[model samples]
Target: MPNHLVPIAFELPHITLRGLTNNLTHKPLIVALHGWLDNAASFIPLLTEVTDYHIIALDWAGHGLSDHRPPGTDYQQFDYIDDLHQLLTEQKWENVILMGHSMGGILSSIYAATFPEMVRAVVSIDAMGPITTESSVAENLRTGVLSRHQRRAKRSIASPVPLTQLIDKRQQHTELSGELVELLIKRATRPVIVEAGDGGTQVVWRTDSRLRNASLIRLTEQQAQELMTELSCPMQIIIADDGLLAKRGLWQQREQWFGSAEIVHLTGGHHLHMYNTEQIWAPIAAFLHNIST
Candidate 1:
């Protein structure tokens, strides 16, 4: 039988935004975060193996079921971290294990560093620290809403992006099982406003793309080190063998930043572990088992 996570908008009474929370109370508390352009459901495949922990996965704003940004809003890196900060500040979770992937990984790194006392451990999948060196940064900012006042026009953020089309796209990159695909389809998207020439409204993705703006919050080597300087718990960094971010001096920089942290490189692309949990779950499970004990 599928374990159904309770459906409730984990909302702070004073806050307009909310997160989807699941309580695995019998297990250790774990906060799992998905990658960029993905949602809470991304962790579904690994959910079975991680029965020891109560995992709280999140749908970051504008990705899954969360709220979209105001027109011309920059999906700034800092904004993502701030939302997490809000969650941590309002909740009473203490020393919970933290796991995040891609952009989520970077956000987790920042959160653990800033609030060392609250984290028990951290698992960063294929990323280390903040992303300030991406070439796309300047390009996105030029056309993106965060910095530029003008609405940068694009021909097609979602060209032919029917749900069918997105599934096809995901298929081309990785081999996914039917059940996994269904779960991803459920959590990864919402209907978007599309001008399909009839002038009527059509639903599509906001864009399955990352930000192009040059990140204002650049990280130097020292700042990276400072992020992990105060952590008193075990640290685990999971790097993907094929992920470009892992190859681009990130592992080295991340190692320097997170002094004394355990590093493990696994096979797959950036979302490899999430897509194919059968193969990738072993190391992750072993790590969690070793640490939780």
Candidate 2:
């Protein structure tokens, strides 16, 4: 945990989103969004490197300390944008800059396109835009429904495990440094009574299980491109040479969608922003400088 990062929460009518901020006073607003399964702590390294702006890093609903959607409801991409809009409206903020990583980057791009007036610029790390599916609508729907049902059927209270063991598991899966993984895991777990009448307790992950379910539908490649074309604000996309966007190679074809966006390529893994903090910040700082002037 960065000593400067302060924990804050926004209370919306339906849900409360939790986040960390370096400053809350009047300054250019830079809203940071983390990738799927990652919470606000994902930006701890990057946020520590920049202190001139009022930066708020949010834990998307259900991912971190944020409130989960009402029961029986499913998570959707559009809902996140709506939540973001509501937050900004409640805060009376406008002309903001969005800095996001991976899934966060994807959502930031979509939001910037949808509401260009509210966004002054966008910084996307390891993401270009929405992911399109080649599967037919019916097939996609079927897969989505079946996946939900399977998840619900298989849902069982996870047995309490040693926190270190859990941290180790997450580090292996994410390939992030143990320190980084520990920072995220500590925020995403809670202690629970595992043995009745024995005063024994253990910690379990706090992430909403429903988050693992697949999205019911995805935009087609053409539809995604059309949406990307609507993004008029200045955009900076940082590509990790070894990240998901690079691995997929789809961003190469989509570059034309954004007429003249600044694209920087760095060498690192998917979570490059977290591990390669300084390397990632150089381009971002320059981008901010260019936009501010």
Candidate 3:
């Protein structure tokens, strides 16, 4: 029987993070991470095929039911690594595998590099490493600060919208099919009382607006390469034929950074694991088999 997803939450010092798990604790654990704007439900498809491992897919802070950052604080790229560290340390989990998609995949690589002993392997889907920049520090800083200010100035109460409309809007930004988009959007939104006394509620996004702001800083290309060199665990990178890292020769260039890594190319869009679970899971299953032996 396919495992059922159980709702779970982690209480950290500053915020509470929520997630869904397959609840198979007897098996080895795989803590899954979703991409930008997506929540834990993004892994629902994979949970059906990945019954061999105990999987917990988290809703990054401000993305799903997780608490947004404290007042006056904006979201930063590197702070996610710290959040993951706190959750793992509190749970006392060790030597586990990390499965991440897109932004999540980037974080997995950096986290594994930072603390290689905690991660037994890493499964990165459609992402090889962190995006790097060649722009001058002054220029990057200025752009990021301006972007945050613009977002803050534009913030306002969003009008309640229909569920179908939310899915339509999200699909416009990605190649994911409507069904796939709906799965994620459902978890990322909540119902709010839109009428003063009519007992009527309408849906509104729960994701923090600060997430759309430009990153305050990014690793330079040299800095990104240096961090990759610290990674020593076996890594499996599943590249989608039409995904962001689909450009030929990209993965090959970064191949040398890992102690042991292999690339598997599958046919699909960026969120292939959701719509193409069978094809995506085969290589991942094989990868895990190879690791166990």
**TM-score of predicted model 1?**
0.77
Shift of residue 285 alpha carbon in model 3, Å? 1.1
What root-mean-square deviation over C-alphas does model 1 reach?
A: 5.0
Instruction: Encode model 2's per-residue lDDT on 1-293: one tens digit a residue.
Output: 76778999999988999999997567788999999998998998888888678899999999889988887888888889899989988988899999999889999999999999889999999999998999999998998899889998888978787777778788877759999997788778887746554444458888898888888988999999999999999999998888888888967988888768999999998899888999989889899999889
Error of 2 at 216 (Å): 1.0
TM-score of structure candidate 3:
0.93
Which window of 10 residues has the lowest lDDT sum in candidate 2? 193-202
lDDT of 1 by residue, 90-197 (tens): 777788788888888878877877778888888888877776534354554454444343325443355434565567567776556555654666565555555656
lDDT of model 3 at residue 153? 88
Error of 1 at 110 (Å): 0.8
User: Which 10 consecutive positions of candidate 1 have the poorest summed lDDT?
Assistant: 147-156
- C-alpha lDDT (0 to 100) for residue 13 of candidate 2: 84
lDDT comparison, 1 vs 3, better candidate: 3
Stretches off by above 4 angstroms in model 2 are 193-201
Every candidate's CA RMSD:
5.0, 2.7, 2.9
Q: What is the C-alpha lDDT of each candidate?
A: 0.66, 0.88, 0.88
All candidates in order of TM-score, best leading: 2, 3, 1
Clash pairs (backbone) in predicted model 2: none
